[model samples]
Target: MRLNESTIVSASPKLIWDYIADPGNALHYMSGVTRWEVVSERRSGLGARYRMLIQVGSAEVGGLIEVVEFSPERDMAWSSVTGVDQRGRWRLRGVGGSRTRVEFRFAYGVAGAGITGYISELVAAPSLRRHLRRSLQLLKRQVEHERLRRDAAARQATPEATTA
Candidate 1:
């Protein structure tokens, strides 16, 4: 099954990309993700690997995944190297001043489980979609908050603030 979701974040693509690229930040913004651990020495670029898991029904599903594509502040994609078959991508585009269009795409299925796999994928679609939507909302909240914090910090550091 394939799922795609997008949201507009009131922050630059760079800010959102920085947050999503860091594996350490995943759990904070990614709903249903119970575990996201860097399994390779490299952390945020192409060829980096992570052991990840997400809650599905009563089970945690996922495995070792490797970063297959990384394009700085634009796109990052990963494919499962072990466990269930899955691929995911994060795409970012600057929409306007300090705003970004962020998209999350995911596809997964059991390769050999036949009819059972098809039915399971169908059954899991709704839950997965919900997770994706919620994750984007959380991400929007986080990056926008960070942007505000950074802007506030910048304002405070100016000479005007000290004089006032």
Candidate 2:
């Protein structure tokens, strides 16, 4: 099954990319994700691998996933290396200024369950969709909040020029 969701974030594409592309921040924004930790020595960017798990109904499903594609500040894609069969991608488009359109897509199915896998996919569709949407919403909040905090700090750091 495939699921797609998108949201506009009040932050630059680079900011959003930096936050989402980092495995350390996954648990902060990814809804239902119970485990998100780098399994490889290399972390963040292409070739990075992570062990992940997301709640599906009463159980958690996921596996070791590797960054298959990485375009700085633009896109990141991953595919399952073990466990459940899955592919996921994040696409970021800068909509001028500090606004970014963030899109997420995921496709997955059980490897050997055949008909049972199909049935499970069908049963999990609604919950998956809901999780994806909520994830994006949480991401938006996180990025925007961070942006505001950074802007405020920058303003406070600058001293007012005294009129001569």
Candidate 3:
């Protein structure tokens, strides 16, 4: 199964990239995810590994995932090797003049284990889709909120520095 979502953020690509590419920010943006912690020497670039947990219907599942691709302010991709069979990618596109469009894609194979995985994916697809959509919405909100805070701080500073 695969899922995709795109959201516009009122900030520069560089600023958004800094947060999205950080390993510590996964749970901050992912709605289904409950925990994410870096497990490799590399932090957020290629080959970095992280242990993550996703709340799937009352059960949490996930494990060590390695970053396969990382391009500063552009793209980030990861694949799981030791746990669930899944791959995910995040693409950042500049919308020109201080705006960014972030596109997220997730692809995962359902294990044919006793028909449960199949059944679960069937029943859970809608919920998972909703989670993904809300996750992107939350990400947009967080980024835009940060942008507003920065702008407010700048506006306040402008007045003080100009007077001095």
Candidate 4:
């Protein structure tokens, strides 16, 4: 099965891309993902590999993926060669000033195990979809919150900006 979702983040595409593109920052946003860490020596850009655990039903299932494509501030795509039998990608685009459109897409198998896999996908996909939405929302909230905090600190340190 295939699933896709997107949201506009209230930040520059550069900032948002910095976060989403970093393999080490995986745990910061992904909802179903319990943990993710780089497995290879290379941590960023193409060819980076990571071992990830994603909660599926009552058990956590496979999520080890490798960076297949990486374009700074624009797009990144990864596919699991060993685990979970899936491929996923993150796409980013500038939506005017200070806003970025982010998209997440994945295709996973519903083959084998017959009705069991079908039923699991039926029940799990909805919850997984919600997790994706919330993940994006949380990313937006984190980036915006950090921006606000920085602005507040800057204004406090230099009151001239506010008064000017």
Reference-based TM-score of each model: 0.96, 0.94, 0.88, 0.88
Best-fitting candidate, measured by TM-score? Answer: 1
Name the better of 1 and 4 by lDDT.
1
**Going through the candidates in order, what is the number of backbone clashes in each?**
0, 0, 0, 0
What lDDT does candidate 4 reach at residue 146? 73
lDDT of 2 by residue, 1-164 (tens): 99999988989998998899778899999999999999998898889999999999998999999999999999899999998999999999999887999999999998789898899999999999998999999999999999999988877777463222
Ranking by TM-score: 1, 2, 3, 4
lDDT of 4 by residue, 11-92 (tens): 8877888788776667888888887888889988899988877887887876678899999998898888676677778888
Per-residue lDDT of candidate 1, residues 1-164 (tens digit): 99999999999988998899989899999999999999898987999999999999989999999999999989999999999999999999998988999999999998999999999999999999999999999999999999999988998889697578
Q: What tens digits encode model 3's per-residue C-alpha lDDT throughout 47-79?
A: 999998787777787777999999989999999
- Residue pairs with colliding backbones in model 3 are none
- Give residue 3's error in model 3 in angstroms: 0.7
Model 1 CA lDDT for position 19: 94
- The stretch of ten residues in a row with the least summed lDDT in candidate 1 is 155-164
lDDT at 147, model 2 = 95
As a TM-score, model 2 comes out at: 0.94
Query: Model 3's lDDT to the true fold?
Result: 0.83
Model 4 TM-score relative to the real fold: 0.88
lDDT (0 to 1) per candidate: 0.95, 0.92, 0.83, 0.81
List runs of model 2 lying over 4 Å from the truth.
Answer: 161-164
After the best TM-score superposition of candidate 2, give how far the Cα of residue 68 lies from its true spot, in angstroms.
0.4
